[model samples]
Target chain A: MEEIRAEFSRIYDTYNGKIYRFIYLKVESREVAEDLASEVFLDAWKAFQKGQNPEPKIKNVQAYLYQIARNAVSDHHTSKKFKTVSVEGHMDIQDTGDPVEEQAAISIEIERVRGVLKTLKDEYQDLIIWKYLDELTYPEIAQITGKTEDTLRVNMHRAMQALKGRLEPGVTPEPVLGT
Target chain B: MREKDIIAKFTILKQIEPRQEWVRLTKQRIMGVPIHERFGFIDIVSYPSFFRISNLSYLVRKPAFALAAFILLLAGGVALQVTNQKLQNGLSLAEEEYQDTLASLELAQAQLQELRVAVEDNDTEKVSLAVKSFEERNAQASKDFVKLVENSSKKALQAGMKLVQLQKEKSQLERVLGTTLGEEKNEELENATKTLIEQELSDLENRTLTEEQQQLFAEAKAAYDDADYATALEKVWMLSQ
Candidate 1:
């Protein structure tokens, strides 16, 4: 019992901040992310209590958290009654990047992309956000979204082109992927 | 860079600042729970990673999760080592303090015995004015005994205070120092001065002496109080012999 407590304590000490940041970045809702993060650890604790070695089961608790977070967001979407509301009311877009000019330009570009993201279908948005925004590999996306990696790859490519075509004429954003 | 690569890197950079309040709330929420509560039969049944997320493409993509886990494990190892050292040092100091207290108590008892015996032996004329010397020594021993008792009690009280103080310090240090012993060791060193004081103070509480010494003190005190300077001088000389 003591050993388990020590183990969790060590895990918490190490990854608490990082996991929270990951969750926050995804849900963009402090309340929902906080609730889901607790659920994540509570689930971890339950696994530990059942005599499972967490180190083997969860390769990375942080990634696992992001996985949970994505589901939580989807769940929120499914469970809600209202329209898809952006959690951007409290978001300070200005704080997204470094103060350097290049970074500032990138930040503006990302915000522009995000603005365009809202126009895509929810599934397309999920793939684009997970691939480009969340930075998950195809497998991680497959794991989170229940999609095959091949399908995810094709969807991602199509999503990017669709997004690029939707960009106002002459913006001609560069290709997202190299051939 | 391709727009996709730019977007990917841009996303990562956007995440760097991370909403502080969100992170704080999440940490507070999940950090307290144990690790096992995280898994559920439902999660296993719904294991997206097993069926839904698997693909050959995953084999080709870089393994970010594996890298993150390795880094966290490394950090955890260093932290554990540092904390272990500090806890060991604290325990060692506590053991030393216990030993020092025992030694001081024994020394106090021994000196008290010698003073008592000197009083009992009525050898003043032969031994540099025995009665006056014995009386002076007896008074000094009594004062020392009182001081020993006072100092011991004081130290005991101080230890209690120290325990509270250390606990508070430990909690605070856990913040700035973190769980690793490396950060905490410096704080321990600073706090060590207090531990030494407690050690010196505790020794006065338990100075051990033989029954013979007790008898000598009792007899000498009785003789001295009764004003039997001659009889006291006799017992004093006998003990010395």
Candidate 2:
């Protein structure tokens, strides 16, 4: 029991934020996303406990959490638990010590891209969020979504093109990271 | 828009995160199971496994059947124990019987050895009488018959040599037994008669002989000097008697 607790604690710390962000992207409601995210972890913990002794129930824990999160969101939507709302949420504050003008300019660019990202279909949004924002590889996405890597690759390309078409002209983005 | 720009835009979602206090509480809620729930007997009875004893509730519901089942189990154990003891007793009895048979075999072998000694002595006496009879009949028997008397005659001569060395007695008998009716046989016969005379004289020491026995001893000495071994043997036996 202690061993499971220690291990589950470590898993919860590592992926809790990312899982919340993934749900938040789909639900677009911080409150509903938090509830669903908590439910996903609780369900995963119960599964881990009830697993066969000396052998685990889950193989890829991160993918399983994402899979559970996906189901939670799907079930929430099926049940019609919350209404959709549009609002300009606050941006994450960072201490990069940039000029006020530069910081404001980057924040505005991030908001414009986010707005256009919301315009895309849920399918396209999932590929972009998991691939770019969540930064998961195609194989990891495939495990969570139960799709082949080839299909995800083709769909990712299509999703990118669709995002590009929806994004406005002359939106000149900030310098890409790691490039 | 460029592909890089699109990816860069979506990357902003990385900053969107749940509240720290809410994440902390949620982790507590997921991990905070009660002690009783961890080891719940209800779960064990409900679980689909061998440990589920709920199906056996009918056994407890009937007292007489339960008592009968317990009595059967106890009787089976006692029967098994009794069978084990009987097997042990049979093994010990078989071991005792084996020891008795071995002892009986040894006693039989000892009795057989005594019978062998008695038969060999009886054969010596018979061969002695047969040799005397053959000389009285002028040696008419075949050579094969002489060979047959050999083992008994040799032992009889050794018995008559009272204090002679056993090797001397054996060599003298072997020499006579190996010869036929020839000069060598006569010489061996004379030598054997002398040995017999010496044994009779040794016996006569510290004893006063009657006049007749003294005359027989003198005659025996004379016959032995003349190489008349048969007469010498006859008078020697009379003196010995």
Candidate 3:
């Protein structure tokens, strides 16, 4: 029992931030994201307890947490209770004590990027968030999404292309940003 | 914006964090207790709502409780088997009664047809014998049908009532034919019987019938061609809504 609690605490402390960020990006309300993020942990705890008794233990807890967060978000969307809150309000753009004009310009720029991201398909949105925003590697994304590494690379390339097209229409090709 | 700039901006979005209060409360709520102490048998007994039947691992570790649980489960299984056997027997008896009723109804229909032919031919002796046989078969079929309806489930009740109505119509037709024959084999009576058969056939066709009913419709048509109008009428009544 003490071993199980220790394992759970380690997993929760390590992945809670990433899971919260992943859910917060997909959902509109911070409150909903917080609730769903907490639910993901509770579900993982219950499943971990069950696995401790007569079931094969989960090998990849990080991937498992992402899977739970994905299902929670999918359920939220399927319920059709979606509400799109203002992205500018939730984003805590670092306050370096900049001028008011510079801060306003940065906020507008962030809002424009968020609007373009929202226009993309859900798969593309997920790929961009996991790869670019969260900085997850292709193999890690593959583990979370249950896809092969080659498939993830191809999908990520397509997602980046789509995002580029949405962000800058009629622009000439430039070198790809990241490996 | 450059691709690097766009990626940088998107990554910055991850800096947003949930409030500290929410994080603290959610962590406390999820991982406040140690694992074994969380859902113990004492906790389950104290808070019945938290007791999940799947959490009987501790009971399985004790040999006496495990053996008692196995015996209880086995006894419950045996009891279920016994109840199922009784239900199967009842269903078989009802099925047999339903078959007997169907056979008697068919025999009554045959006798009724013979009576109709006898009436058409002005043969009083054959008509008398046919009437007696038809009455006996019809009475038996009605009794068996009632038994089937009483013994069977509610789903069979509607079909059983329809069979009862068909029997009543057949008896009415028999009475009309008897009265018509007692007076004379008039053209009016023959035409009346023909019109009645046609009306009943149209009614049967309008209904949303099953495959068995479509076959019965074809059989009724054959009976009509053989001048067995009584059997055709019985088939049509049997197909009623």
lDDT, each prediction: 0.48, 0.60, 0.65
Second chain alone, TM-score for each candidate: 0.25, 0.26, 0.40
Each candidate's fnat, in order?
0.16, 0.66, 0.42
Off by over 4 Å in 2: A84-111, A169-179, B33-241
| Model 3 chain B worst lDDT window (10 residues) | B180-189
Across A1-179, the per-residue lDDT of candidate 3 in tens digits comes to 76887888888888888888788777776668887999999999899988986654898888899899999999987875554534325443454344334555665665566666666666777778888877888888888888898887787776666656545533333323332
Q: What's the ranking of the predictions by TM-score, best on top?
A: 2, 3, 1
**Weakest lDDT window of 10 consecutive positions for candidate 2 chain A:** A170-179
Residue-by-residue lDDT tens digits, candidate 3, B105-163: 77766777787787679786776666566656655655555455445533243334444
Candidate 3 recovers a fraction of native contacts equal to 0.42
lDDT accuracy of residue B201 in candidate 3? 71
RMSD of each: 28.1, 49.3, 28.5
Give the alpha carbon lDDT tens digit for every residue of A115-173 in model 2: 66656666666788888877889988898889899998988887776656456656543
lDDT of 1 by residue, B46-74 (tens): 33452333453453475765675557568
The TM-score measured for candidate 1 stands at 0.37
For TM-score, the strongest prediction is 2
* Candidate number that wins on lDDT, 1 or 2: 2
TM-score of chain A of each: 0.55, 0.79, 0.76
Model 2 C-alpha lDDT per residue in residues B173-231, reported as the tens digit of each score: 43644421111132223344465556655666557989988888888778877866556
lDDT of 3 at A177: 31
